[model samples]
Each structure stands twice: as structure tokens, then as C-alpha cells.
Target: MNVDFWNEKFTQTPGLYGEEPNRFLKIQLQSLSPGYLLLPGEGEGRNALFAASKGWKVLALDQSPIAKKHTLEKARKNGLDIEYQVCDIEKFIHEGTKFDVIALIYFHLPSSIRAQIHARFEAMIKENGLLIIEGFGKNQLKFSSGGPKNTEMLYAIKEIKSDFPGITWEYEFEGNDILNEGIGHSGEADLVRLVGRKLSDYLIKISN
Candidate 1:
């Protein structure tokens, strides 16, 4: 992720992406109770702001300092408190903390460290805690809605299963959807959406 490019882009467009949360994330919120939530690569704070509004203690991370400033400004305006940090995946220090829910909506990570991040996520959630991920599928190159132009940054269902092992995936979909979240994402999109729950070691074995 190039911080300079993002900083420049965000500086140009204050509301580059609209303020509405992703519809998929909004749907998941209907069933989930607010708690400690972590959002990685949370650009523009669309999801972070909504989660905070719902009483979730939100910790949002991104590589762009401008994104943090924008997010914090919005949080303040809305009277919602959210922690937005400008850090890369390597520098994010979360050792003894565990969260109730961790959402990765449209956060496209490079393939190099994606597996490691997925493994780390399994250990960071409380038992039976939720993990929600939505990204452009590998086949997304055909669509221009919005996503990493690089295929390596796109997700595949088989790869996802391998990345997040020892968990119960309650919902898994690798297909298409129409995204109208904001100016950043719109039109028909090829997407991969997964919602999983962390399980005990014994339970994982039994379920498998």
C-alpha cells in the first residue's frame, strides 16, 4: 500500500467514497451484538463509523495517516468514539487483546502476508467470536466495480478455507453482487464473502 498515493487521493476527495456502510456488513450487523470490533484497512471510516454508532468499540487500521484524520473527524462530528490508527500490518501490536468481532470488508491485502494474517486472526478472537471478510474474488478482474487490479490481491474460496483453518464457516459465498456503498465501489462486482466463528480445539475436530 502506498501511503503517499492514498494520502493524495483522500486529500483530493474528502468524500471519495460515500458515507454509507457496505450493505453486506450492514446485514451482518443485524444479527451481531456490538462489542470490541477491529477493522483492518478501514478507509474513509464508512464501516468504522457505523459500527461505532451501534455501540461497538471500534479499532480501525489503515496505512494512510489522512484516513485516520478523516475517520476521527467524522467520529467526532457524530459523537462516536473510535480508534483509528495509521499503521501497516507489521507494526500493529495486539498481543494480549481479544476481540468479539473482526471485520475485513474490501480490505485487499497482498498475497505475501495474507495467510499469516488469517492465522493470526484466528488467535485474536474470543471463543465463538465472529470474523467477517468480504473482498473482490479472483475472477474480479472481469469487473471494474472496484478492487485491486492485481490478481494476487484477490481472494479465492479454496484459498480462504486454507487461510482460515480450524474454524466454522457459517456462510461462504463466491459469486457476484451489486455494490453501491460509495463512489469507491459501485456496479456489478465479483465478490467473496465469508462469515466464520472461532471454535474450541475439540469442537473444531468434532465438527471437521
Candidate 2:
């Protein structure tokens, strides 16, 4: 999607994905210690703000300027400060920066570029860092709640395993579930959820 497309989406809805953090993401993040965290494709800053409030330094990236604006506004309202950037994932430069946790919730991209982006994120994670993901499954096309219409843009267990190789999967599953994330995502949905942890030294390194 282009900047204008997402900009319009964010502007059209007061809170497209709602003001609350994703339930799966919130529960997983709460189990870990506060540290540097990253949220990609974060619209309106719900998850970012939630992480910030929990004493985690959050850095959120999205292609929409409208998203950045709304996200910052919410952060300020909650007396929290977050680093939000408006840029395409294809052009984002990691600059050797690393994070303790990286969360991907409802973030989807074309199969043509998804693997590369996932690999890039994997490399940016510190040793033993966590990677939490929850997104639409191929079956989600049957539902209108949310997610990309293209099945190729959706996820499958094998695809995710291929994208983030070497990580120890603490949880991995593909199935259907109910979703109520603002007006954007609602009703029954097919989804893929994963929780993995990078290994430390003395452990076999997993390369994407």
C-alpha cells in the first residue's frame, strides 16, 4: 500500500484499529522485562503507547504520516513519548540498531517482499530477544473483518517458519479466532500466531 492509501485510511477513521493494544501482543509483552521494543506497521500507536506505559522504550514505524500524527497525539495524551517514523519498510535503514522485542500485529506485506523484511527484523533482534507475530491466515480471505485480500499476502505456518529460521518457537499455531480491534477488525477470523525467541551464545544460531 502507498502512503496516500494508508493516510486516507487513518484519517477517515478516528481510530481505525482502536485505542487498545492487541490482546495477544499485550499478554505476551507483559511477560517480559521492559526494554527497547519495535512495532512495525503500527497504526494510530495503540500498541506502542501501551508498551511505553509499561516502561518500554518503543519505536513504531508506518508508511502513513496520518498514522504518525495520531500515534504521537495519543502518546502525548497518555504522558508518554515514543519514536515514530513515517517511512516505507522497503526503504527503512536499521543502522545496526537492535531491540529486545519486535512485535508484528496485523502487519502484512506482499509475498514478494515479506521474507526480506522478516529477515531484516530477525537480524535486528538482540540475543534471546522475542519476536511476537499475529496476522491473517490464507483462510482470512473468506472473512471481511480485516487483512489483505490477496491470499499470497496472508500467512501460513510453513511460510512463517521459513521466514524466521533458527528461532526457538515457543508457540506456533494457525487457526480461527474472534477479533474486535476497533472498527477495522471484527468478527470471526482465520489467523496465524507465533511467539519465538532468539538463541544466545553456545546455542545453534538460526539464520533467516
Please tell me which predicted candidate would have the highest TM-score against the true structure.
Answer: 2
lDDT of each: 0.86, 0.89
Q: What's each prediction's TM-score?
A: 0.94, 0.95
Name the best candidate (by lDDT). 2
What does candidate 2's lDDT look like per residue over 1-208, in tens digits? Answer: 7888888898888798888999999999888899999999998899999999999999999998889999898888889989999888989887755889999998899999999999888888888999999999999989989999888889998988778875789998799999999989998999999999987634544331
Q: lDDT at 12 for candidate 1?
A: 91
Shift of residue 160 alpha carbon in model 2, Å: 1.0
RMSD after Cα superposition, model 2: 1.7
Model 2: runs farther than 4 Å from truth? 201-208
Query: Across residues 44-146, which tens digit of lDDT does each residue of candidate 1 receive?
Result: 8999999899888989999999988999998999999998888977667787669999898887778888888877877788888888989999888998788
**Where is the poorest 10-residue window by lDDT in model 2?**
199-208
Query: Per-residue error at 65 for model 1, in Å?
Result: 0.7
